[model samples]
Target: MVSISDYGDFYKMAKRNIMLAILGFNAQKHFCDTRERMVSNVLSSLHKLVAVDPHSPLNFREVYTTELFGLSLIQNLGEDVCSVYVEEFGREISKEEIFHVLVHEILSCVVEPDWRDYFPYLSWLPNKSFETIVSSTEFRRDAVMNALIKRQKERIARGEARISYIDFLLEAKNSTQLTDHQLMLLLAESIAAAVDTVLEWLYREIREVCGGKAVTEEDLPRLPYLDAVLHETLRLHSPVPVLPTRFVHDDTTLAGYDVPAGTQVMINVFGCHMDEEAWESPGEWSPERFLGEGFKLADRYKTLAFGAGRRTCAGSQQAVSIACVAIARFVQELQWTLREGDGDKEDTMQYTALKLHPLHVHLKPRGS
Candidate 1:
């Protein structure tokens, strides 16, 4: 049940570097290429919409996009992590099902009343109920990780190795000094780190930049506006509004105040992104802010969407590549209009920010 956060500083640094190498450009390029092929397959089925009666609007809602993008993300990650496709009851597991369980369990832990928050001196008290709930959730999460890791070990024993996170970890098992439990937790953390939308201006950008051809990763450099749209979307609605808590092992000072050792600190991503000091008209959705010459991608701390510093998200590049290409392709092929009455739905947050009501949209083939 130990997470990467529980590791010593050296172990944490080593683990992060391994993740960085696994999720670096070269690996991401391969993952993105695989995802694009999968996306093309999915889009192929949707292409029939071109011939659907122009007067009819296709009902594209949360369920549809969740499957489209979620499946793509998890399947690609699954392959890259262990060369396995996760399934249950002989069918592929849906992203909604996985998140529904994981998020609920996680949120339960976050909201559940705990005495430690009120009485640090009484922290020695046993909280059996909380412990039981956490244990159950960990079991569920670990089952998948164990299965994947076991399969990779079997593959390695058979001398059928592939370049993947699990394969890499299995090969370095002894040298890295990571016990099976730590390795599983590290892999789980990496998976968690790897876990996108905007359309209007994007539609215009794709049409202008890509023309009749579907957009590719090569087109990303030419579509600054599209990148702006993505950044703005994240700024306005970060997936993880609150970052994972960081434990302070040694007392430190921040801005002005002292943070004692053993302190758990959480960064408010939503607040940082909306800071008036850092952004003009902070409350408004303006992608142009990111388009300025001052904004440099090399500055990792510029925005906290993917986090900052040595622990910045390992999958940031992979996420951007996948999202940019997928979005461009969708815009290039389909026209999206928010469905009637769905615009007023406020966002809700759990493990990530989500729509209070599912986003329903009307879709028609582009140029129709």
Candidate 2:
């Protein structure tokens, strides 16, 4: 029941150290070296879905893409960072388990209100129902995480000699003064946190740019329009609609009238992205606004979808790379059109923004 401010310097230090390990140049290069295999596996899984009956409509919803994306991401992250292998799609039970624990169990608990948060003095008051639910969810989450750590430890005992984030944590356990439970939570947070599109114009762009060859990571730099499409999409449908709460250490005025030292603040990410003052016709889906010479890769952060500053997403660059390559490859191989009824569903938010209803779409091979 610790409040947001309860985290101490050691916690922050451990997180900083872990983030540096995961996001450093060599770690990023490892991710890059494995990108081709990851993308290939995803595309292969996708092909399986649409290739069935070839002309039939596919649901092509978030769940489907999530599977493709999650499996690929977990496979790379697990292999490179955890020394574990997540099965490919179809046999991707591990990926599904990870998502279930992360999105359903943990995220559900996150949005649940706790009486203690608003009234610390009432912390002793009985909260049996909430406590029961949270406890159950935590048990389930810890089960999954503990299993991964246990497997990693066995690898270490076997003298596998693999370098991974988990190995780093294990080695630093004594130096960091991190208890087993603390290490488990740190690994859980890392695993949980370590967790499209305009078609028509982009199809033409790919055809012109790649000339019928598949889009590769190298070609991403040349696809500025594709970059705009991604930026606009992120602006409209941010990764997280409301970021985690922040604790104010000193009194300060914010937006005219906020002056309290102990106040807890939260950013309404969706509101900021849709701010009329900042973006022209903010509700409109206009990729062209991001085009021309003003466009820079750094501009992708302008929406703050991945957060801003040092606390920004550690996997942001890796995220962009995977997304650009995936989108390009999809358009290069298939024709995509939204199903009639799905075109109007508003985006919904849980922990991340998602469609109120799953997106349904029709797809066909390009030559067909």
Best by lDDT: 2
**Candidate 1, which segments miss by more than 4 Å at Cα?**
1-17, 45-115, 194-200, 292-301
Tens digit of per-residue lDDT, candidate 1, span 1-368: 22235556655655555554466667665566566775686566556653565454454443344444443334323343313335433444445545544444655555566777678888999989878877887876666656666666776788876666676666677877778887777666555441014566777777788777888888899998888877887888887788878888999999999999999888989889888888777788877777778776753255688877666766677678877777777777777676677767787766567777667556677665
lDDT of 2 by residue, 190-267 (tens): 555520346778888988999988888889999987888888988988878987788887899988997699887788
For model 2, give the 10-residue run with minimal summed lDDT. 82-91
Instruction: Name the 10 consecutive residues with the lowest summed lDDT in model 1.
Output: 75-84
lDDT of 2 at 10: 68
Error of 2 at 201 (Å): 1.7
Candidate 2 backbone collisions, by pair: none
